[model samples]
Structure formats: C-alpha cells, structure tokens
Target: MNTQPDAPRHVVATSADADTVLRRLAREGWTARSGFALPDPAWDVAAHRIVLHGRIADDDTETVALAVLAAARGAGVVAVCDPESAAGRALIDDLSRIGAVHRGTDGADPVASLIPEQRALLDRLAAGDTIAAAAAAEFLSLRTANRRIAEARALFGVRTTREAVLAYLRQRQPE
Candidate 1:
C-alpha cells in the first residue's frame, strides 16, 4: 500500500486560471510547497494529490487531461472549474462518469488492433474532451467518431467509450 503522506505541494498546469488558483491557494496557506512538471510526471501516482482547475497545455489539447491522468493513476484528483463555462461543465459531468483506471496487460493489450483514429478518439476523451470535441480534434465527424468507438469497442472487447478508456489506460500507453 502507498504509505506516502499527502504533501502540501499540489499540482497545477500552465494556464492563467491555474496560476490564479495557485496564487489563491498559496495565500490561503495550503499547498505551500506546490511544484510542477510536464503532465505525465506531475500526474504520476507519486505526484501531488489534487489537480487544480484549468487546462493542461502539456496535454496538447489544453484540457484538464493531466487531471484525468492523475485520477486514472488512482491519486483521487479533484478538479474545480467554472460551471458556467462549457468546458468546465463538461469536465464536471465527464469526470464523474469515468471509472477507475484498470490494470490490463496480464492479457493481450486490448487496444492492439485499434486504428489510429480510434486511439486518437480515446486519447481525447480520456483527456476530458467530449465525444464531439474529440471527434473534431481528430478531424472526424461526430458520426465517424461514434462509429470509431463502436469499432474500437469490438477490437477492445468493451461496450462503451468509458470501458475502452480504462482498457487503453491499462496498458499505460504514453499520453
């Protein structure tokens, strides 16, 4: 079991809003030892506990992807975003629905047969992008994205995007 005590150093991505939040938290005398890194290390299982609000530029999509990665690594990451903003609302909604990151590779990597589009779709979704948004990011129509998901589901032997996400992460494939 992880015996590391929670450090006062919370994780933050490179963004204006994130900077603002970090300032406030510093003033509040919380996470006084705050630190940062490129997304993967910052969100690693050994990294900080909470991923404060704002997009992670390191994620390429400028979304709260590092936060999702942290959560997937079982860090119990918490994100706070403006409910009025569409992106924030999506994070609030989607984060709640994602399951714990699973452990695979004890079997074949389920994502092995997936086409590049399917992999791209899951990557965006795992980064907290909505399906339509993920679709657009990959230059695919909503219909095509959904079709990719359906096809990927068969390849991964999963029923939903969420399931496919967990399966994909199970391999710890680089972000």
Candidate 2:
C-alpha cells in the first residue's frame, strides 16, 4: 500500500489502456513491471515515477492507483475502465460522484470480476428485514458493513443515493 502524502493519482483499468500508459511511462524511462499479482514485491512507490497494476477490480484499480499517484493532491486517484463492465460503470459513477477524474474507453466491456466475494455477502445482506439488520447479518459489524457495502455499490454500479448494497437489502426487507 503506497500511503504516501504525495503521489500521482492515476488509474489504468483495461489491459489496453494500461498498455498505453505503461508503454508511455517505459518510453519515458519510468521503470515498469506487470503481473497478475505481486508476491511481496518491493518498490518505493514514491520513488517510482510510474506504476502499473493489472487484473484488479475497476474500482480498486482507480481508487488504489489514485491513492498512489495522487497522494500529493489530497489523495488523488485515477481509474481506467473498459466502459462496458457493470463494475466499470460503478467505478466511474462512484469516482465521478466523488469528483474523481475517470478516463478510459466508455463502451461497456463486461468487467465483472470485481466482486467475486460479494455475491454471498449480498445474499446474506438481503436476508434481513431492515437496513441495519441486513448490515449486521452481512458484515457482522456496522462499520465493516458500511464500508464493504459502499464498496460493493461502487463496484456494481448500483444507482442508489446511499451507494450501498444495504439499499437493496432494505428494499428486500418486508415492512
């Protein structure tokens, strides 16, 4: 986690966009590496002029990358998206709602791997009769539920003002 107070915040979501950005950085003599996941990879994120990560959720890509790249600008972040993915859409909406600059081809590309762990969680959340109860059941902690559900909302591109899966849970709950 590059939690520096000053870092460039940028996002590269799709493999293509990432390729463009990374190649540009490489052309500029910015050291770059790409893989499915890192195994205790060690690099001073602050020291690197550019960083690239792939196969991450659209939201995570944007939010985390922004946190890394835009740390100097009050936690700046950027996310690239394929445009066709629901998760990508959600990422765009979430970032846009929060005034984050989202860049990429917005043509919808089915970027659906963002919440592989969330289906069961959403199912559990829907089992309760109230928002708070659903939160309790799904997350077992209000703070955790709040955070996770909000992330889910952003990952799924659900159009609710609360930006939480709890909104779905609450709706499913019988009056």
The sequence of per-residue lDDT tens digits that candidate 2 reaches over residues 29-63 is 55554532223344343454444444545445543
Give lDDT for model 2: 0.44
Report residue 17 deviation for candidate 1 (angstroms). 53
By summed lDDT, the worst window of 10 consecutive residues in model 1 runs over 98-107
Q: Which candidate is the best by TM-score?
A: 1
Task: Summarize candidate 1's per-residue lDDT along 67-94 as a digit string, tens digits.
Answer: 5544455344333344335544444333
Question: What ranges in model 2 sit over 4 Å off?
Answer: 1-49, 54-111, 114-117, 125-128, 158-175
Residue-pair clash count for candidate 1: 0
TM-scores vs. true structure, each candidate: 0.37, 0.34
Candidate 2 worst ten-residue window by lDDT? 105-114
